[model samples]
Target chain A: MRTEDFLRDITAIRGLSGDEGPVADFVADAFRPYCDEVWVDQMHNVIARKKGGGPKVMFAAHLDEIGLMVVNIEEDGSLRLGQVGGVDPRILPGQRVWVYGKDRLLGIIGAKAPHLLSAEERSKNYQREDLYVDLGLPPQRVREQVQIGDQVQLEHRYTALQNGRVAVKTSDDRACVAMMFEALKQLQNLRHEADLYFVATAQEEVGTRGAITSAFALDPDFAVALDVCHADTPGAPAWRTHKLDSLVASMGPFIHPVLRGKLVEVAKEQNISLQTAVVPRSTFTDADGIGEARAGVPTVLLELPLKNMHTTVETLDSKNLREGGRLLAQFAVAVNEGWEDELWT
Target chain B: MLRDTLQTLLGAYGPTGQEHLVADKVRELLSGHVDSMRTDALGNLIVEKFGAEENAKTIMISAHMDHIGLVVTDIEKEGFLRVHAVGGISPRLVAARKVVFADGTPGIVALEPNTKGKKEPEMSDLFVDIGADSREEAEKLVSIGDVAVYAPDFTALGRHKVASPAMDNRCACALLVELLMYAEGQKNTIVGVFSTQEEVGLRGARVAAYAVEPDIGLALDVTAWGDTPQTKLPAVKLGAGPAVKIMDRSMIASPYVRDKLFEAAQAAGVAVQREVLAFGGTDGGAIQLSRGGVPTGTLSIPCRYVHSANEVIDLRDMEGALKVLLQFIELA
Candidate 1:
């Protein structure tokens, strides 16, 4: 499959926020063929560097996904869950989950039957504390196979929807990761003077930790952070969402206004659809961390708009992913040694 | 004697991005005492005092020269200068306080009164009144992006204590200057970096450490005091000597370097506090994480009301810290 089309495969692999070894290995392999060098940091940040003699430009996209962890195991072989990132408990009823225990096991999220619930309890929404994961095994077997801290991924069923839209788990980020891979693929044919570092960062959901260290180590002169933004979904606040088809570029105090304008310029020149996100404060993305790295890097956040963000079914229009890659690749070409001087002007 | 040096440094007008004045002051003090001195791209003044021993390792000692300030974001039509914090300065702390621009032009910070009862005003609601009657007159005094810090006013608090606006870091800069002047026949190549933009995010030290690439690093800064009532968690006190940091939000102290600080304190016969700051960080956090990670620690002068107009520190703590740093260069 084309690298841009591999978002489903990338999202299928489990890589929770601080435990991204599996995701790192796959991302490193994908990046190995396209860049000068690829290496994984202690934080599992996959950094693929393309050496040049000009200013360094870092392109970052997080690889970690939202999930739950086994917080407790009852005597009846049921597991209690705590969120690893922002797992909405609203979608957890009777869903199949992948329990990454001593052995890979399948389990079902169980709740009280509606027929047996009291009216007071039934009137209210199901709280996460009211749910448990039932593994089909004896309590002793559960004790042997599972531990309290083992990662549990919510059920994911990748679906190809009508009009080239696709739904999959963890696409809030992995789609952007795949989009970076596509950018790397495109940069092969482009001419650029800047040293480019394509990084699949880890632990962004927790607090942009990977970007913090990676940006510090690389000390890039400029950076662009790619992540998914909430696309237009029905019943969602219209002012807060973007079209599912257009790529997003955010401007705020943390984001370099000039660098963001440069992305828009590139998008316009390349005939790619781009939208502006006027974030007043923190972008709450990797850009927030990368821009503050060292004496401060001129960093901008470019986003792919997806529907149903932070859910198991993050839906995206596949063409925009490829469009975002092309735009970023062209942006890499647009950045020269003089771009730093342009930022202040 | 160190209080005199701090008084001299506080005279210089320097904010986060504008630290050259402080660097110039530091260079003037340490000119003939050090082997070499230079400034980096970000205006960090790195001074070297060569060791008199064979095969000595390089130990980078950094004290940030930058202090908190507010920058002009826009000028309102009514001649008021709209501002935002360049560092971590709060609107509540700066309200109705006198501020000085880099060029010695002074202004007063004022908050707009709103009918929104009892709610704290934001930086947007705050403006600087430079006594300018018109926008044209305000433009003549300060331009957009020009920064202004709290007007410097050194106050002696009782004895062995002094309170000042930029004392959070100018005191540490004074201490480092004292170390460079007095640290003689040391076993390590002492690279004293009067770093810049530390209040912004340890930016100067991050790149400075990468360029210096020292075997060991230490940040001289001030830590918050818990001796004041209702401030109980940090467990540090004023006049209790300099604190050896355990950890802060930025980087955890390397255990080897942290323990060596205690040993140096013991050797110097100076009392020291153990600082565990729940918030705030220093340049040591950047130096420790630089290029394969050099072992680093911080020596903090315990100060009350840090990042305020009246940051207070004890002179005895500076004297004690100077003694310990002289021992640390050889032992660490």
Candidate 2:
């Protein structure tokens, strides 16, 4: 599948943290042709492995996306919201959502209208409890269709921006999953020594659950978790964010230094546009969990610079995704050619 | 006997992101009972008890070995240590509490006196005093990044309850170890994972569950109780047997697994309470969400004053958990 198509298809599917079946199945099907063996693990992590003799390299991208869950149904047929991961309440008011229940139903996150709100209430940050999803049905019918604990995802259409950037609801991670698949496609003809495993992990937004398990199961010599990091915008801190057009290679306590160094080297050798970010403690990615896997797996994070993370309109440069894919493919090939000797040393 | 084991495990120092010593102690205790054992990348001690049937389903019983503690971030000029939380150590709990470093260095955690009348002191206002006169002396005893757990005397309360530090988890670890010794002839291939860094973010259980790849996963951990005055929610009380977890902040217990636990408890004639924690998560949270998802639930030993230095648990609750776990493994 093309990167754009893969992103579009997967992002359209609702894969909230604990509930990620539809998207997992979609990713598994996309991985089947490029991999020697493709299967979904007990956690719904799609593991596609290309068998080889040398060190094992696992590439992970989470399939789960941040959204809302129905915590309660009000008497007025509106649904009370509980976050699936970390759904920002500020962006939720008036946003459209697809409530996954007995059937997918359109709903709008409703809050008190600005005109009716007092100055104090208008100025204060909105809490998740203040927002409710208006499913436009009677209380009895809404209760019948949308039960408590049903998943709700933002309704977004994938659209290309003016300068090669794309906006979607779940670009925080679905873009990375697309890039990993693209990287796998790029490596299909290459004679790499490492056994490459492409894992589409689950429930990363809640916690890096899929990476934790899949890394232990694969027991790869080294792994790279691909995700999207915040991109520099007008008001955001420049030092902490990357440009949307460039790939971000994370360096931190959670990341293995040797793995980070090798990725930097590979990016430079391959002429991939890269930026570096230092995460002192938790990278808040699958890399954190994968790096600390039993005995420890040497792991690094490859981040595609994303704008407006965890919002309905997450934007990212398509070129950065392609570059990240290329970088991952080169890194896998480099590891295949004895990157372990340098890593161990 | 259970009290002795709990005392030893609770007395051990195994902070999040650093649980080797705890794993070592657990490995030593479990070595004789299990057929094979190994520690995984995240320092999860996975020990397997073989079943008589070759194709029996694999069941993973997990308990975190690590606990909430303080990590020294810096040493001040006056020999006081600036520390950060290794897990979710509340500022209120750390103040005026005795703590011990890995090498048995004793210290008192104290908050800077509130001159400005702040309602609650932040963690930054707290420091560990080891009675050292200078930074050199403090450095000689504790290094940067060294972890220290609360030092509390384990005391038996009445006949059935015991109070100690880290009963949130060490009680569960001891329970798993006891199960390994007593739960004979399991039908399933039982993997006991004494996980690490669970207090941090369920780190060890995530990977450990993946490594074990069990058909069923169960976490033996402590749950909060509402026996105290002014308690309203969670309705669980100490001495109410083991609580079968229904949901928490991390993941909801799988209904099938929760039902199966209820069935096992019923079959074994063990009284069990239902747990619906308002906050906090156990290893089962990560295990249930492990690859594609495992049928996972938690057998919670109800405890009072969790995450504090003087956490208390009932011995009968521990026994109830073991009974249900043994029955679940055989019956599932």
Candidate 3:
């Protein structure tokens, strides 16, 4: 199946951190057709395994999404909200949201009319607190149904932009999860011998908690942490952003150098355009956590360049996401028995 | 009974780190109802109500006992006292508010005059006056590190709603205490933790979760309301019913546990709202991420003006939450 197909299916779901059950199930089902065994942990980490005599390898990307949470309810039936993850309040006003209350109700975040605002209020942007959701329900019915603390999801609007680009909610890490699916689809035929475990980790948005636990549970000989990187966006600093045409293999203290070198070599061998991201400290992905699991696992961090990092329209280049799959699949095949000993050398 | 229990707990003098007095009151109420009870290192009152079935899940329900207060930082020579907020006390809200120390010493919080009109004031712009002549006289009744909370002023608002300080959690405490007293032959072991220092942080619940390592966790607390005037969003109303927390700053409610709460509401034939709080946290946050992890959700009593004097809640919501908890313990 196409990566966009998986993205289409996954983006519409509302699975925030610590509440990724359905997303985990979807991932497990997605991997079931491509692997030998699959199971979801209590923490909702979907682990799909393929046994082999070669080195044990793990590929992971978080499956959770960022959204706003209901903080209060207005008597007139409006809903107050807070950020679930790094939800940009600047992008909130006039945006449509899915209120996951008694029902997955359609809600709109309204901006106060310019006529209603004073000159002082007009000069400033609305803070997150200034925004409230209007579910368009009666006040009494709203009280009967909606609860405080229900998640307000970013409405899933998949826009296929020019030049093989797709914008979808949760494309940040879920795009990488789809990339893992792409790798799995390719690995069905082009396998060497690595015992592969593809994990769609939970709660990565909440400080990489799932990666820490899942890595400890899987204990792979080699791990490849795949996630999205900031593609060049308007007003974003050039130093921190990458292009959308290629996949990025990050090199830093957290990433294993030899393993990264091996990934770069595989990308070169596979003729996939690969870029390098120099993260001086924490990669801020599963790479930091998986690298230190049980006397250290040789780990590599792969990045798919995406635009609009935390906004509803998280854009990504389909070509780069597909290239990431090929690179990861080739890396799994390239990780032979001597790969572990070569880390020190 | 929930109202009376809440009123009693609200009357107890317990600040963030000083919840032993509240715990004492809780013990007195629950002494005979629970199977076992103990105080943890953090002064959390942990009590268990056993189930009839064997191999049942260890479900922990937590309601914090501590209230937000002002700690005496320094005393002025003229007897006005300098203070720092212990929790989420807004200087603007506390100005001209009445407070009382644990020893029944009453005082009034006063805000310094702002030279610029329409300028926002801060804690530094505020002070406490205890009708004292000098620093020594003020020190005789109050000391440094002594906490002063909103003096108890419980008033019934209209019919269903009631107003007071510390109703943020005392309402939940009442819900838990009543659940323990009401539930019989439940299928799961219910451990009620009257946790300490939650207003400061989830300090008491953190250690309590480590000790209990429960199979599931639930936090009972008050959530903010948007029904009153300009406070838009959060969609929760006081008189409607209790709320089921979806996510908060401290945690994303575990789906299995949160969904079961919904089912429990259905089973109990009670009303419940889905909650998504942006600010503050409950003990469930600590319990959800404890050790490996525990499936956890929060049941919130819809409260207004939380952390301020005259915090308001509806008894109907408390009743709905108690009904849900009674059904929840049996199902979970």
Candidate 4:
């Protein structure tokens, strides 16, 4: 698949937590061309199964994105919004977004003119309750056009910079999902030993409920979850975020020792560049639940470097996501080739 | 009912690593009822009881015996002892308070008189004065490594309310002992573990959990309530009853375990409150994730002014907890 086409198609669907039906349908459509069978689960997770006569291997990523839920719309065409997942309030003011109404409506967050503001209010941090959206519509017209509880996403147009980075909304896990599709396209005609269950999970942004339920249902012997990692930038805490150019290998209570060892072996064999993020316990990811599900299931987390996450312009080097996909595909191949013979043995 | 024993235990000076005094007191009281008793590496008291069925699932109950105290770091020339907080504590509660060292040496915590407008003195600015003129004189009675806690006399405020020091968790330890005593005739295997160093990151419970590996685990502790003015309005009120926690910041209790507790409370006709604490954690965090996970729940005794020298609780809440817990053990 063309990288540009993959990015556009994956970012087009609106899926936030419980409302992942459209995103699942889009993923199933995109994955059917490369897999034997593609289906969705009761929880709206899209699973594209590649037929194989060997051990089962699952490549999983989340399809949901962090967006806003329109709670109430005021009489003067202003809307009060609540974040569906974690939304950084610092970047929300004066930002343009698309309100997912019956017909898409363009809106911009209305900020008061600084000249009119008093000294006390200006000294404080900006709050979501103090902000509203300007849809450029009359009071009655807006109520007639956009109802309450509609979802809204940032309308920042994708920017492919000279440095090979893609600036867009929902690059967090959506980009991870796109990489899986690209890998499937590349491995279409390959004869594999392990049965591949590629799951595009939903609602991972809101406390990893999608991954938790999916892991419980599948009950795989081993699992890997792909999510975005914080990238180093100006004003970022040096200790928390890593450099975008470096591929961080996470080690912690969330990562199983066997899975971590296997990842290290595969990276060594493939000669890939990798760094490490050592967490004391439970990285607050789907791996927490997957590690303890049904007696236990060993899990690993492979993070794609991202900068300014949970904001309108959450940026990522597209090449980093591509490399992450290569690493994951390599690990899948390694597991598939030696599953019953070496992994269990 | 258990207040006498809890006050006696709380009055004893037992810091994180020096919990032997309180553990020995519990050992003496509960020796006859338990089938066997042993102390773990962290000084956690583990008591066992045999069950009726063969290969019955082991159940573990935990309560930390450590209270927030001050650890001596330096003895200044003027006999003022520089101290560090043994656990998480606010400096506002330390000034002009009475503290007793491990060897019964008395002291008064004081802040510099120059900082008058200070709402609270940082641990660096606070010192304990044991009324000695020189460092040598102070060292005669107290060592540089001695630990001390604020001493508050227990008093009955009203018909059901009682105020005392270390009530934040002495109530929990007392309840565990009472449950062990009440379950002497029962058939199920019970492990009552009085943990240490819970305030220092739940280190004791983690080790105890691995050893127990129980199918069911219950953490007994005190929870905050809206009895005082500063508590958030529309919060859990005092005098209601024991709280059955559905969710807390640290651990989300399994819905199945929550429903079972609720069902048992209904059958016994006990007054119970459903709790959803916005902050603070419990030993339930480690217990729930132990040995590939265990179904866990918390039975909390609602207390006001927790982690303070003068924490208050209602005896009716304790009675309610005992009733619901006895019923749960029978049905679990």
Task: Return the top candidate by TM-score.
Answer: 3
Which one is best on DockQ? 3
Please compute the TM-score of chain B alone for each predicted structure, in the order given. Answer: 0.99, 0.97, 0.98, 0.95
- Sort every candidate by lDDT, greatest first: 1, 3, 2, 4
**lDDT per residue (tens digit) for residues A31-131 in model 4:** 89888999876557788888776656656678888777565567697877766677776688878888987898899987767777789888976777677
By summed lDDT, the worst window of 10 consecutive residues in model 2 chain B runs over B226-235
What docking tier does model 2 reach? Answer: incorrect
* Alpha-carbon DockQ of candidate 3: 0.32
* Share of reference contacts found in each model: 0.02, 0.15, 0.54, 0.00
Give the fraction of native contacts in model 3: 0.54
Q: Least accurate stretch of 10 residues (summed lDDT) in model 4 chain B?
A: B226-235
lDDT of each residue in B86-194, candidate 1, tens digit only: 9899998999999999889999999888766757779988999999988998999999999999999999999889889999799999999999999888888999999
B149-253: candidate 3 lDDT, tens digit per residue: 889999999989899988877888888899999988899999999999898879899889989989999999999897878875466788888988877778778
Q: Say which prediction, candidate 3 or candidate 4, comes out ahead on lDDT.
A: 3
Error of 1 at A20 (Å): 0.4
How far is A53's C-alpha from truth in model 1 (Å)? 1.9
In model 3, the Cα lDDT at residue B31 comes to 78
Q: How far off is each candidate at the interface, as Cα RMSD in Å?
A: 8.7, 4.6, 3.1, 8.7
